[model samples]
Each structure stands twice: as C-alpha cells, then as structure tokens.
Target: MTSDKAHNLWHQTCAEQIAAPVLSGDVTVDLVVIGGGYTGCSAALHAAQLGASVCLLEADEIGHGGSGRNVGLANAGLWLPPAEIRKHLGDGPGDRLVNLLSDAPRLVFDLIARHGIACEAVQNGTLHCAHSPSGLKDLQVRHTQLKTSGAPVMLLDADEAAARTGSAAFHGALFDPRAGTIQPLGYVRGLARAAMQAQALVHQHSPVLRLSHGAGMWQVETSAGSVRAKSLIQATNAYHRNLSSTAPEYVPVHYFQCATDPLPEELRATILPEGEGCWDTGLIMTSFRMDQMGRLIIGAMGDLDHLASSIHRAWVRRKLIELYPELQDVPLRQGWHGRIAMTSDHIPKITAIGPNAYAAHGYSGRGIGPGTVFGKGMAEALLSGNDISLPMPAIEAHHERMTGARQMFFETGATLTHLIKARF
Candidate 1:
C-alpha cells in the first residue's frame, strides 16, 4: 500500500536502502523466521551469529510494515504505568520486564554503533510533555515510580519545559535521559544487512502461505519456495498475514504522522534546539520532534489516510498553529499512517504457538527497543528450547476479546475527536 504521501518521509531521508532475494528454491535451515521487521531482522541476526543456520522471510520489502513507519521515539517500557504492569503480571515478573526494557535504548544504540548502521541515531533524550494540569500530575506520578525504580528521570518545571520545547503550551515534563530516537527504517534494514553478513539468508516478497510442523521440523511454505527448519519465529507484529498459523491477536490502533519541510534556520534554532523527541500525556497522545534535517514531525492517534483523514489533517493544522503560532500555514510535506497491535492489558506477549515455534507481538506502540530485545531473547530461547533469558514469561495461549469491535471503537473515537477538535 505505497501511497505517494504515505511513509515517504522516511524513504526520502533514508541513508540506506536494503533488499534481499525472493525465495527461489526450497532450503533447509536450523531456524526459519517470518516477517522482516525489527523483530525478525534482529532475531535472524542474533540466531545466525549464535551458530544457527537462519533464513528470514518478509511479505514485502524489509521494514515495510510498522517497523518502518513508526514515530521513531525508541521509548522505553510499555505505555502502561509501572504499577499497572505490576498489577497485571505481579511483582517479580513485572519488575523483571521493566528492568529488561529499561535497557532498550542502550541495546538499540549499541547495535547502531557496532554495525555502523547509517540511521540518524540521537541519544540526547526524550520529553513526555504535560498537556494539561492533570497531565503534569500524571508525569509526577510516573516520575516518582521511575525514580523509585532507580531511573535517573527528571521532572522539568513548566518554565524549563517551555524552554526545551520552544513553546509555552506544556505544563511540565518528565525527562528520561536513557531514551532516544532513530531512523527506524534505516535501522531495521541495517539489521537485515548485518544478519546477511552473519550468514543469515533474508528473502523479500516471500509471504508465508502455510506453516506446518511434523516429524520434528517446521515447514514454512511461500509462493516460490519453502523453508524447513528445526525452529520458527513469527515476528511479523502488527502486519501478520495469516496462513496455517494463527497471528497474535490484538486491538489495532492507528497512528498518523505528518512531517513538515525543513524549518528555516532561525525557526529551527528556537524549536527543540537540543533535539529531544516529545509526546504529550493526553489519552489521545500527540507527539512532536525534529528530524536530522530539521523537519518537524508531528503525530497523533488516528487513521490519517482514510475515512477521517480530512478532519484529522485539518485538526493537525490547527494543532500546529496552537503549538507554534509561527508555523501557521506551513505546508505539511507528507503524511502517513501505521497500525499498532495493542494488547488489552498493554503488555507485549511472547506466546508459544506450538513446539519449537513462537509468536511475539503487542508492543502497544513501543516496538523498536522491545522488538530488538525480544528478537535476541527469542533466538536464544529457540536454541535452548526454553525462555530462560527472556524478560517476560512465554504464555502457551494468547487470545484477545473483541479485537474487531475494539479496533473499530478506537478508529471511531479518534475520528470523532478529530472532527470535533477541528471545529473547536
């Protein structure tokens, strides 16, 4: 679904374009990985390095899914509050997952550095802006929790927040120095290239039509060929295409982003000068950041390509004016949207689909870091025949209730909000 205006911002600024051969003949390997997004690429890279003969397949080009079209925040932890996570998974496992994800930024940055990935990686930090008084209060609570958990997060005062954001719109903010941003598509593609260097075979346009297991091996069938392996990893995330295997069930959430052309030099100096990505605390999150080329990218939760697109776009224009009056009438270079696989409980799931096979999904909009960590963990787990080093315990069954209805509800809610807000 390549619209001229969809997901083109990243492509225009991409430092590298990577692709692999389409499946031409049947091949046998120690591991078969489905999907070529962040998780699949990372898993294939790690597994191959760990002495496994790995072959990865993608339905489209590498990172053509959510992995390529994300907000590029590289945020740590799930969208759920820390206490809520503890409430869901209990104390020990909850703390363990949090602790593991806390290091997501480092893992991602390290990979970029080690592999010399050309993605524009920024490590300064990120800002969770308080969109309202209540939003500030939410940040305060999050700040306390993060501090108690040994994180060096700072709660910036209103004045400081204004100074950093270059706008006086926010009440305050929680600054996490550990978090950062990246060129997502570039990063994912680089992972694929690195995997290839490590002796992993990656095939593009190889959609898995059937997946079946028998006689101690998993057979994954595609159009032109098939892969038979001792183990399998389904890392498709939100872009799962069904075959004989069941994709991870989730409530789909749409997030749309609009990138403005590079700001003038004088305007750029006053806006996000220190280069920290930002997101608000509103239930319908609004995010803003400047890319390496000084283009301002703003985003929110909604379908920006279809039914509610006009309203969403109009609202965004209003939002830009409200956030920065100087930016009134500024042209939006391009707009795009991506799907997020959100779990009801806001936790990522590593479900065991069958013997020696796993499906990991439900990042709830936090994918880059967790995806990498999960990929590394899933690869090791496949080899060891257990999830010993994985952050979260693998469940045997993962089923979501009313996924279709919930997805519709989110879209409708976002549409109505955009429609109403645009008028207001």
Candidate 2:
C-alpha cells in the first residue's frame, strides 16, 4: 500500500486542532519566516516571545511536512559524532556547535514542559544499536568521544543490548541518556500553537511566491499578500519552496517506515520496555521505537511508498522475523515515507542570501533537536541583527537536481544494492 494510509494515521493521531487563517492582505512585521515546520514555528515562537513582531507562512497545514511525518526521535547533536565534527569543523567551531546541541534535548523537553504541549513527550533515553561486530567498534569510539565531552552516555554489551532491545540482532548499543522520543507531528503543531498564543501570526496554506530585498528591508511575497520585515529566515529545510533565487544543492534522499498494530499487554512489557528510541549502525540506517499506544514503528533506508514497494515490504517482514520470531506474524498497520535533504558532507547549513536574510537546511535525517536549536539560534540572530548565532557562519546558496529522472536513478540504484545484498 502507499504511504497515504500511514500518513493519515499519523495526521489523525499526532496533529492537534488549530484554526490558522491564511494571509489575506499585505502586511508588515519585524520579521517574516518562511516554512511552518518545527524550525519556522520555533523561530516565530522565540521571536514573538522576545518582543519581535513575527509572521510565519506555511505551504500547507502546520506539521504537514517532514516535521509532522518524522519518526519522532528527539536526539541531541547531529548525525556526525563529536570526534568527526571536530575533524570536519576543527576544534573551536565544532566544539561550539557540539556544546550547543549537547544541551538541545534538555531545551526541547523543557520547552514542551514549559509550554504544556501535549505531544506524548518522553525523555527516557535513546540507543544506537550496533548491527555488526565491527559496528560495535565504531560505537565504542563514539561512546569514548561522547564521554570525553562530558555527555551522559553508557555503553551496553551484547547481552544488555539484546535485553534492552528485545532482539539479538544487535551486537551492542551506545545509550545516550539525554535523548528521547515523542509524537513528532504533534510537537510541531504544538510549537505553532505556542507561537500563536505568544502573539505571532501563523498563516497556513500561504506559500511564499517570491522574496526581494531593497530599501533596507526584506520583502516576502505570499500567494495572498506580501510581508515586509527587517529580517527574513528560511526554515523550510527539506520542504523548502522555490520562492528565492539561491536554491541550495542537496542530495534528495527518501526514508520509509512501517508501524505494526499495538502489541498485546503481555508482549509490551518485554519490547522496548524502558521506552527508548533506537537506530542501528548500518550505512543504510534503521530505526525502531514504540509509541505511547504500544505500536511498534520500524523505519528503514529505502523508500517503500515512493519506490520498490514490494522489496521494502519484504525487507520489513524479513527484518522483523530476523529480530523477533514472535513478531513474524504481526501485521503492519501503517506505512509511510518522507524525503530528506542531505549534503555531501552530511552536515546542515545556514546560508546567507543577502543582508538580513538567512536560509538554513540539510538536516540529513536528524531534524527534531537540531531543527529547534537552529531555529532558536536563527531567531536570536535575526532579533539581535547579527549573523554570529549560526553554528557554521552562513554561506551563499546554490540550486540542486530534484528532477524525476534523477530520482528514478536513485531508486534504481538503491533497489539494485538491496537486491545484491539479498543475493549474497
């Protein structure tokens, strides 16, 4: 089946009710934010709370994009480990960003608590499972790096890993006590609601058609009207619109997920009993987590709804059987897929298009915490009229290939690789 079914399940359960009108007439604000996902809502909330007149525009309903459709893992730091970050950005710049993100989970959970947003917030922890013996070595190094940086992390041996995950497929796991999970779509919607409550104007179904800067102000033109502001922030990330000249070049990657019906009471106690989110060590990563309702949501690399539907279905079934023989007969209740914007270096970017205009994207599938942190930083920078808040200093923007033919090529490549692995 297509992801439409899974999409509906997520939307119905996660999205909170909110009545946001579309932009009707030309308006002026201290700042205008494009994209109404977590980052955009976060920017609007922070800016509005800081006494900046803010207006946010969304192409669709709040949480309709990746923010709402995500796997709901609220993890600190980026996909890159701390040592690799230091290697890529050097000690000073890398350490600053790492330090900022290390505390991001705290900020996220705290914000949820402070705002009283009901998104099934949980901070139990997260586990990075090692799929192979060699993967355990990598996890060991990462554990060491995290410890050196003073992060609250633990290394689980094979026995402990199996016990915690309820599967012997993983050799070990790197447990980060700071990480957690939630209902992703609900969280994004909550952010929008919070921003609205704080007096920020959030418009749904208002995609920016054009953006121009002149006369010492940034003007964002929407379908219904125009917004003039002293500063503009692009928080679209993966769901970015073509309203600006500087299109960022990124590899368009897709990830798919499947969720089983809620487990029986007897089984729920042994499966992810502590309620930790988990992802494996494979290059083509896989994630698994249980919802508050006891449904098992399993995500993998290939795009099932987008391409290779049968293969993806087969893989999920095979994977579940391999991990837990008891779950081999469990039927899948939901299946969905979402696109990811990935840079060649696997790091997100904050690019500057003009004076007082900044755009950030490329989350590389790590969105929740980084998105919120980046949004908060971007809002601070725009409010204070400074660009120093960005983790990596903003750079110029460029366009990328998202053509149908290219997407087909990628799908074919992934299919072939998976088929080859199955054959071997």
Best by TM-score: 1
Which candidate number would show the highest lDDT if scored against the true structure?
1
Model 2 stretches with alpha carbons more than 4 Å out: 5-8, 398-413, 417-424
* Residue pairs with backbone overlap in model 2: 247-398
Q: Could you tell me how far off, in angstroms, the CA of residue 123 lies in candidate 2 after the best superposition?
A: 0.6
Q: After superposition, how far is residue 134 of candidate 2 from its true place, in Å?
A: 1.1
Count the clashes in each prediction: 0, 1
Residue 154's lDDT within candidate 2 is 98
Question: How does candidate 1 fare on TM-score?
Answer: 0.97
RMSD for all candidates, in order, please. Answer: 1.5, 2.2
Residue 260 in candidate 1, Cα distance off native in Å: 0.5
Candidate 1 lDDT by residue in tens digits, 56-77: 9999899888888888998877
